[model samples]
Target: MRRMIVLGLGALLFVFPFYYMFIGSLQAEPDTTVTSVLPDPGNLTLGNYAEINEKVNLGTSLLNSGIFTGGVIACTVVFGVLAGYALARLRFRGRGAVFGIVLLVQVVPFQLLLIPLYVLIVRGYGLADSHLGVILPFAINTTAVFVFRQFFLQLPNELFDAAHVDGAGELRVMWSVALPLVRPALLTVVLLTFIGPWNEFLWPFLITKQADMQPLAVSLANYISNVAGRAANPYGALLAGACVLAAPVIGLFIAFQRHFVSTDIGTGVKG
Candidate 1:
């Protein structure tokens, strides 16, 4: 009906820019005086993709990004789960204070912490020009901890009691009983945390001046800012770099979107 048509138009508007960018990346460099949103089929070429690799080592940048983002994801998953489970289930002094502090961390802008992180990770720790240094500042995500804690809080207390009565240790209880039930939170936090370190340019650029150590974002940024306009097909080359930078994240979400459905809490508890 009319509503369906409206929704279709909205979707088209949302998708048009991406489609435009992809097509533009396949195009030959256009003359500055010429104006057309669509590229001619005859003018389409893969030369732009080849051009981007020359300006930045795409292979090395991807490897660097994988190492950085993967490390952060692993560390976040392990630490977020531990802290969240403790906050939700354990009896301890200063639990409220700890949770409050975690919440307070989310309120502070990352920019405010940038200076201290630079000094500590770069100068104090002497980890400059290293993958560990790039990964250090983002190892634990406070927002992820809060998310895991909330998800743990939502599960039935009976589940924990049953595990405890069975003489399960705390780690055993978490891994076997509680962790299985929070798959949605894991996916969400992974995706959310992925975006931060994946698209991160400033921190990585600041951490290392070496070209081989830079992530895709930093290299692409350097390309777009300094070298793109000098290319024979500047616009196409720029968009091609963007496509490379965005492809993995978009593919990940598409692959994992099916698992992002709501969790059925009642199913986790046994009679």
Candidate 2:
């Protein structure tokens, strides 16, 4: 009973902030000064959402987010899988050194690389104010590469041997034999990569000043600072933006939760 109480309390503690944000977002007025995190049932309204809609073109922002996140996921998957397969299965010169470099890159904070990356994307390449500019930098994620490499390594060597015996080239074997068994890793990387690019406001903000081209996070950030505070219910509008930003991420995780299990790519090999 004690354990159940603790678990329940922990769960509630984790969820209460989201609940508070949702409740505050629906209220007719901002609840910034209110001591209670719980909503007052009598005062609940959708007016804050309506107010936010009037101030920002949420539809455009959502579309931009789709484009940006989609591009990043696509590039991350293709290149990450290829690089990972090469590192895991292929024997090449300086392969260990290259892997070491990948690991080293992960230890460095993105903030440390931000200035140089910005200069290259903006001044060097002259790609400022462009979608390609925003998407290009995040295309190949090191974390995604690492995740794919680990998954590929878990694959049994016999699987590759069988494919090769059947006249399959390395690329064909990677695509046909290896990838099918690592669905979980793909989903994992997709979700991991999705969260970062989807929620990222800074790089996109720096790359493009045009509101139409900016993702939902950037637009919501701008609204929070510039327009949301000007509204009658600043806090409510702010929470509403948070809700909008969080909804898709929560939905994707829920949808993909079933696919998170490992398939043990070597199971067939041992059998």
Candidate 3:
């Protein structure tokens, strides 16, 4: 009974914000009398979404978001696995030092690099407001490296030994053996990378000033400005956009489902 109560409470807490946001988006923009976020059932309207589409290029923003997220996931998966495997299985001079440095780098916040990275993007690479500009810097994620490494370390040694006996090179082994064995970790990495790119606002806002180049988050903000400025009933449309922004993530979670919480062998260990 206590567990059921706890779970019900937890579910409510988790769901309430979205419910409120949806409700608020459905409401007529609060007039002098209707100050509350909750909308009167009769006053529900789709004006907010219409106003947003008419004013802002939301479709373009979503496309940019998709491009950015797809690139991030690709880079994170490929690079993360390679770096992780090297740290776990390979031996070379400065190996320990390199691993230490990599782990240390992970401790640094991404926000700290924003200014310097932005300067580099703007001036050094001449890639101002370009998709590659944002994608390249974030491609090398230290945390992903560490995560991959931890997972790789947990891999059984017998598999590597058998592959070596069969004259399989490291690359071949990775492609044929290691990758298949670590699907869970790969999925985790892909999901994380995807989320970071999809939901990121500040960096995209700073780098991509053009409305077309802006992501969903930035575009959504732009939508808010247009709707509120005109005194339109933005309830349904804003909620619809929010749902659009959230859909991929929510779908991803649903597809991954039990995997999100269930511990698989690939991520069974932590460094």
Worst lDDT 10-window in candidate 1: 262-271
Candidate 1 positional error at 66, Å:
1.0
Question: Ranking under TM-score, best-scoring first?
Answer: 1, 2, 3
Model 1 over residues 1-271: C-alpha lDDT tens digits?
A: 9999999999999988887878888888553344546667788889988889888989998999999999988998899999999999888999999999987876777778889989998899988889999988788888778779989999999999999999999989999999999997887777767877897788898997888989899888888888877788888888898999988877876887774444422111110
Output the TM-score of candidate 2.
0.87
Give model 3's TM-score versus the native structure. 0.84
After TM-score superposition, the amount by which residue 204's alpha carbon in candidate 2 deviates from its true location, in angstroms, is 1.5
Candidate 2 local lDDT, 1-271, one digit each (tens): 9999999999999998988888888988666656657667877888877777767677888898989999988998999999999999999999999899888876777777789989999999999878899999788888677778989999998889998999999889988999999887887777767877798888999997888888989988999888865678888887887899899988887887674445422110101
C-alpha positional error of residue 213 in candidate 2 after TM-score superposition, expressed in Å: 1.2
- Ordered list by lDDT, greatest first: 1, 2, 3
- What TM-score fits each model? 0.87, 0.87, 0.84
Residue 33: error of model 2 in Å? 7.2
